[model samples]
Target: MENDGSAIALEAHELTKIYRMGAVEVHALRGVDVEFSEGELIVLLGPSGSGKSTLLNILGGLDTPTGGTVTFRGQLLRMDSERALNLYRRDHVGFVFQFYNLIPSLTARENVSLVTEIARNPMSPDEALSIVGLGDRIDHFPAQLSGGEQQRVAIARAIAKRPDLLLCDEPTGALDSKTGVLVLEAILKINRELGTTTALITHNAVIAEIANRVLYFADGRIVETRQNAVQRAPGELAW
Candidate 1:
């Protein structure tokens, strides 16, 4: 699908997710509505259980919502089947999470190559690693790399497919402040340089300063949305 000049990358309307446990139904998302523009970086901030991760998963096609709709480039998401969702995810989305999820036995280059091999059109493993500042360590195994480096490799593996959207869920949750900053910097760089529509879930409010837009979630809803007049670089953020 061709995006119009205004270029809305993704849209979600009245999104709701519920989990059933015996007789209890727990609401994870309740009537959430949001939009992500092309090349824009968004930060989702909220306390635990506020639905930030739930929204991200829905947007990434990893989870189906109980109600409402989601669209990408004006195409309605086929959430009715896992096969369709998996195809959508493979074609359009990349994901990063708190855990690196790297294969311990594979070299960093090999790890990234795994995704590129299946992608319709993908960059070389070295090229993807280079974007995240791991050009020199592409051959290093995950076991030999630091936590920060492993995370960067994960980022590289995600983006190597040249996905249109990148969804990150607490990607820096496992790192120290200094190392977290590096990971954030890599994400910022990817969004800016690759023109990837990026949405990141972070508990650190300070990290919101690095985004084009900030969304605050509470009680399974987006309580507030703010446009950052002046976006800060990842290095400029206090945490």
Candidate 2:
């Protein structure tokens, strides 16, 4: 792996995460080492119980590794103070999940505004919505939108904070292939226009073509890493 600190956005070294379930020990991660650069889109591919989400969670500061180091832009995160982690998560990391966790009663604008209200420097909800091609549907409720539109709203909410990184775990899992492609396009646009570093975790191997780098996991270990010479757009993806 290239070790030039200047270009790296996130780095993890020998990361290991273990969970104790009474008398049983669950090793969720085993000596994983990886680095992601700014403005790069990376896909994490794995099977169930493969620790793909575990790695993404750790990278986003949502969870701490049992034994390892995670650094963001040269700032050591594994041992950071709780307050520091909180600030890091709030200010720099954007997360999108398989489910659109939007407030059911809130309009799309309001949902995006919720995060901007607490951010140190945030884009206006309208601006964020426009970026996701939701400008005209800003006042629509979650129930009024299609699955793809709802996911775009969720994406707008996540990026409203102008975060340096976006962590998505199965972002398109809830949508059909056509709708999922739209959601993926929004993600791709965010990375292109906003220059946000992105990590997407998905079971679909086909999604890897849309990423600049791809990581494959199995049995709680990183089994392979491949860099794409050319990334394809969502519509160009094979699957």
Q: lDDT tens string, model 2, 89-195?
A: 99899999999999999999999999999999999999999998999999999999998999999999999999999999999998988888989999999999999
> Please, what is the whole-model Cα lDDT of each candidate in the order they appear?
0.93, 0.92
User: How many pairs of residues collide in model 2?
Assistant: 0
Worst 10 residues of 2 by lDDT: 1-10
**Candidate 1 residue lDDT tens string, 41-155:** 9999999999999999999999999999999999999899899899889988999999999999999999999999999999999999999999999889998999999999999
Off by over 4 Å in 1: 1-5
Count clashing residue pairs per candidate: 0, 0
Q: Which stretches of candidate 2 lie over 4 Å from their true place?
A: 3-6, 78-80
